[model samples]
Target chain A: MSDAAARLAYDVIVDLVGRGSRVLDLGCGDGLLLARLMAEKGARGTGVELSQAGVQAAIARGLSVVQGDLDQGLADYRDGSFDWVILNQTLQSLVNPSLVLNEMLRVGKSALVGFPNCGHWRARWHLLLTGHMPQQASLDYRWYDTPATRLLTIADFRSYCGERGINIVREVFLTDPDGGRPTRWPNLRAETAIFVLAGQIEGRPRQRP
Target chain B: MQPRSVGIVKTEYVELFQPPNELRLDSGEKIGPITVAYETYGTLNADRSNAILLCHALSGDAHAAGRNNEEDAKPGWWDDMVGPGKGFDTSKYFCICANVIGGCMGSTGPSSTNLRTGRPYGLSFPVVTIADMVRVQRELMRHLGIERLMCVSGGSMGGMQALQWTVDYPEMVLSAIPIASAAQQSSQGIAFDVVGRRAIMSDPKWRGGNYYAFGDPPLDGLALARMVAHITYLSEVSMRRKFGRRLQDRERYGYDFATEFQVESYLYYQGDKFTQRFDANTYLYITKAIDYFDLAASKGSLAEALREVTAKFLVIAFTSDWLYLPAQSREIVSALKVNNVDVSYCEIESDYGHDAFLLEVEEQERLIGNFLSGVAREHGIA
Candidate 1:
């Protein structure tokens, strides 16, 4: 991600997270986001990263990060262990996004999910005109070497959450790398989508601040 | 830069629990006037906060680093990782390693003379548990004027002590690194220990643990026991790579009952070398202590057991270690997570099996060095 977009995402996350709350960052590369959450939001942060180098770097930063694969599920954490569980730009790469999303909700009261919007107008036009797989700044990898097993868009994620009874508490759409103002038609225009998701809480009284 | 050694160290002894002030064993027995042999590297900071206690594994002694004498051919067992610029980094931290109570290495073990009878205690010595070992180390710590340790770390049996230290004296430890170990000894481990003990007892020279007077200890039996235990310490891959069914000193089998295979010769050498430095009775006691170790036995669950632990943890495991499986370390990590303890766990890629903790020095150096520096920064000791 570009520096501006990354900073904007971090700012949004920091603003949404309550002060001094416990936060867990899944696939926290080098623990940059977790450190920012701790410093800017007073959040007690923990991280789980798969790469050995990432884990080492996170640890060197004095972050509590366990080296683990996200695909294996979050069985180490108990139900509602953290106030917020963040998975940034890593949802599409997951082998079982549905199971992981369920696990995230089970382990945290709220989850923040971010992913590239593959159904953007530019991507669609490129695929239609070129008769090849779509390639955009967000989803730049070729189909053969892409880490994303599930190519999803803003609309696809919204429908999936709705079908699974997940409540979208908040959301933001980035139309450009500069993190311009949130776009109205995120499904077709936005390059990246971020959402604050929670499990079914219709009848329950909200305890979160 | 090449790691500098602590260099030319000496073992020291301290006597604790004299007379009426006796150490109460888990078996409800009391033993007084215990002598603990220990070695220290680096200088203790003024506030005593820079102290890092290093626990030794099953056969390891207090000689954790540096050479005992100028002419000594070999340094301490863990010299590779504990030195001036190595993992423990004596230049930055005060490192201490104490021989366990039931050890043969200059500690008050079965070989120590029982003051009452002026004879080796042998089997008469009260069975010591891992908790008991930590208790002795705690007394040693108090004697040395250290109030809180910067970290407590070790691998295998030593890792058990590190875990026990956190649960036993949570406030005393700031951080912990339990490597290649388990919360409780697995049944397979117990089975091996049992067989080793049986081997020692079946020997005629063992004489019901009264072999000291004869001046001929159970050499063959002890060697056989070491041979068996050593096999568990190595992986099949390591064994294959190291010895691959090749003949020891001959091109072909001699068609006689002799150590023909290279693996057999290696085991024999390891067993023989072990007998030279270790006492058979001490091995039995130490293995028994390892078998009796169960961190969660009294607390009902591992999470509950570690609920009171306040120290940050760094738990490590080796992928090829079937003896102390990576799954066991995961159990520790899982329990620590349940309690919301700040923990870091990694299963290092290694083919060294259980011995990886001792042999995989480069990776350990990087992980431990980084982890300790981070802990030091948090404690304001950096």
Candidate 2:
């Protein structure tokens, strides 16, 4: 995409958010996301990032970022402190993804979660014949460097959301197999999956420090 | 016309009732049974509702507006904004401006006698914060018999104190205008202060911050600190406009440490001139006070601390101010908004840097005048 296109998209997202709403972004790489949101939306954002370089970059970008191990917990932030907590491209990287999802549900009034789908038929064949973890376009890295703790399929995600009573406000499926236009059956054909969650809450858990 | 100067409260009366004082700073130090010095213009109404307090910046004195003497070269800094039919319009409001707690002017400062030591406190004066300055102002207001103020206004360090007042006694203030100030001093801000203090300490006559006994103050260090800080007060564009690498005497560079350029010479002149009247230790104390001023940290929650502020707010920040920056003003606005405080904010387009608060006349006067008029009308004064 063009640089201007990306910037415009960011601006659109900020415009969608209201002023003074506390925002939390999982895998918040650098604070550009938060700083841009603060400037355009007049919102206050706190980011949870993993890398030292990312944390420093966020601070320089004038966004508040906290170093955290997302796999362990997000207990520091008080419940309901955030209006919309987002986990972008980071759900599948967790050892126990359910625990983190529960924490997100607890802390945020709404959530925006995006993940990669592993239920694609091609991936099933690659796993069945090659007898190795499938290296699809979305999971590009070599086996050693790959970050998928356990692959999650589109069906699996939907079932968990339903069982846990987490409402799916919007579900977006990206089937852009190449650099070109997206196709159908994105869960099996597409590289990325985007889902925005809102409203519903279930499976209440006890508070942990 | 001759510059008019009147003791709003004479020295004797001020000492007796509204005496200036110092803090036993958070660092286990004490400042004074301070002798605050101030001047007032216009008259206080029977209801005392017409009072407007003017908080001056770091280098300011009690002479906020109006001339202190007929022989004075220039009128006070805010004189244009606070006089008959002027911005603050003292004719319609009782305007009060006091030198802050740890100031030099005629107010109690490091030079003020310490009751326990029977000597000027010098370095012994405890570092005071913006909060302490506001507290002292409150004391003065109580002594002056003013129950509530129409407004509290200032820029830079004065802005810091003005904000402290609104948060400290929200009910007492009807309005607050804090211009070109930061909620917390940035790392760069503290770096300048640190270097300034180092400059003072490096001077041979500094005497480890107790130069009063030596009878020779650390003029060199103080001048250096002023030179550093003054550079930050003005923008690069302002400096370029005022002096664009223009030579002071001959056209070519001196090729030495000598200040050959007009800008360098101007800074030197400003520094040397200020050293004649100011104290090095007082610089240390006051700058430390400013550096320590973080309203959020002290109170823990910005929203709660400002929750009681029902007063209207006019928070102004200059675009050219890299020292304070617009972000600080935004933070203040954020806190105020969370508490549902009534406020109007503007990041004024100016290239004069933080000092724009003092230099910009027409824009400032118009905004302040109209604002006060609106508020006055609400109170039935206009």
Candidate 3:
């Protein structure tokens, strides 16, 4: 993803998180978003990153980040321990996305998930015209070496959440990364998607933004 | 650039716990007129916020860096990691290291004279625990007028002391780095200590822990104990690399009940060398203290024990450290996370086993240097 899109996603997530909230950023590469949450939103933030270099960079940035793989799950945190759990720009790369998504909702009152939309028009055109795996600015990786295990679109995520009875408290689809505009027909037009999901425990009231 | 040493350091003695006022041990006993042997590197800032306490491991002393005398051939135990611009960074932070009460290196221990009997304390020295060690160090810090420490760090048994400090005096420690250590000593670890103690007690020259006047201080027993404990500190891979099944002196095996293999010869040398400095009684007491360390035993859980700990933490483990496995460090990290403490954990890849904390200096330097600088910034330390 472009730096502008990443920054826009961060802005949206920062706005979604309340002041002084506790946050756990999963797959927090270099802890940039977590640092922003702590500095700008007054949130108590922790991060978990898989890469050694990423964890080192985060620590050097003065951020608390545990070096761990997302596939292992967040068994260390208690239920409702965090106000917000974030998995941004790293959803497709996980081997067990469902487990992590469920674990996030279990551990936090709410969760914010962001990913590049694989159904964007450019990706479709590249695949349809060239008869090869799609590669674009948002999902820019060769099929052989890509870390993404499950390429997904905005619609797919919405239906997956609906099937699992997970509530989407808020949604933002970014068409113009620099402009920060939320585009319609996001599955086809938007390059990236962000969703704020409420905790799905039985009888628990949905949290307000 | 070559790492600069603290250079020509001397061990300082402070008499704590006067006759009337004594230090209370975890075993419900009190000892008086305790002398603490400590060494300091760098200068304590005016506000004293730059002070960092370094706890040493078993068989270690207060001399953590630099030479005690100009003619001394070797530096302190942690010389590689505690100097100007090294991990502890004497140039940036005031580092203090004190020998535990149950120690032989210039500290009041089993070898110290009993004021009443005018003989070595020997078995008469009250049994000490890790908490007791921390308590003495706390008194030393108080003597120096440092109310709060910027950080407390160590590896192995030293790491246990660091952990003990955070729990025993939560308000005083700003940050901690417990490397290659567990919150509790495992049964397997206790077994090793027990065997080592047995080696000392079975020797006739030990004379029921009263070999001080005999002029023969159970060298064989002490050497055997060192040999047993030394094996725990090394990995099979390291041993293979250092000395496989190779012969000691001749190309062919002696084929006798002697130190034939190079590994056997190495262990004998290590054992003999250790007896020259370490006290057998002190070893027994310190290992007993290590065996008694269990951070969660009374608190019900590790998280409960750490709930009041406000210090930021950096817990590190080595991949090949079987004595204190990576899983144990992860247990600490998990508990710290459950309490919402700011903690960073890394299981460094190394084949050096339990000794990696001492051998893997470069990686530790980078991680600890960055972590401490970040902590200093957060606390507004110069």
Would you estimate the TM-scores of all the predictions?
0.96, 0.63, 0.94
CAPRI grade of model 3: medium
Per-residue lDDT over B1-382 for candidate 1, one digit per residue giving the tens place of the 0 to 100 score? 2349998999999999998999999989999899999999999888788999999999999999999898888989999999988999999999999999989998899999999999999899999999999999999999999989999999999999999999999999999999999999999999999989998989899999999999999988899899999999999999999999899889987999898999999999999999899999999999999999999999999999999999999999999998899999989999999998999987888998999999999888988998999899888995
Q: Score the docking of each candidate (DockQ).
A: 0.69, 0.02, 0.68
Weakest lDDT window of 10 consecutive positions for candidate 1 chain B: B1-10
Cα error, candidate 2, residue B32 (Å):
4.7
Q: Tens-digit lDDT track for model 2 on A22-125?
A: 78877777667677777777776767776645654654454445445688676544566578787866887877687888788777777777666787777788
Q: Which model, 2 or 3, shows the larger lDDT?
A: 3
- Where model 1 places Cα greater than 4 Å from the true spot, the runs are A1-8, A199-209, B1-3
lDDT for each residue of candidate 2 in B25-132, tens digit (9 for 90 to 100): 466655446678877777998878899999988788888765555566767778767777777887788988898877888777787787787998776666788888
Q: Estimate candidate 3's alpha-carbon lDDT, on a 0 to 1 scale.
A: 0.91
Candidate 3 Cα errors over 4 Å, as ranges = A2-5, A129-131, A137-144, A175-182, A200-209, B1-3
* lDDT rank order: 3, 1, 2
lDDT winner between 1 and 2, please give it: 1
* Every candidate's lDDT: 0.91, 0.75, 0.91
The stretch of ten residues in a row with the least summed lDDT in candidate 2 chain A is: A174-183
What is candidate 1's lDDT per residue for A1-209, written digit by digit as tens? 56667778778788889999899999998989999888888899999988777887888777888988889899878878788999998887898887889889888888999888888899899989999988787766889998877898888989998887789998888876777645677788888888998843332576577
Poorly placed runs, candidate 2 (over 4 Å): A1-209, B2-13, B16-32
Expressed as tens digits, the lDDT of each residue in A1-209 for candidate 3 is 88887888888888889999989999999989999998999998989998877878888788888988889999989878898999999999999999999999999889999998888888899889999988877767888889986899888999999999898988888874564455667788888889989865423765666
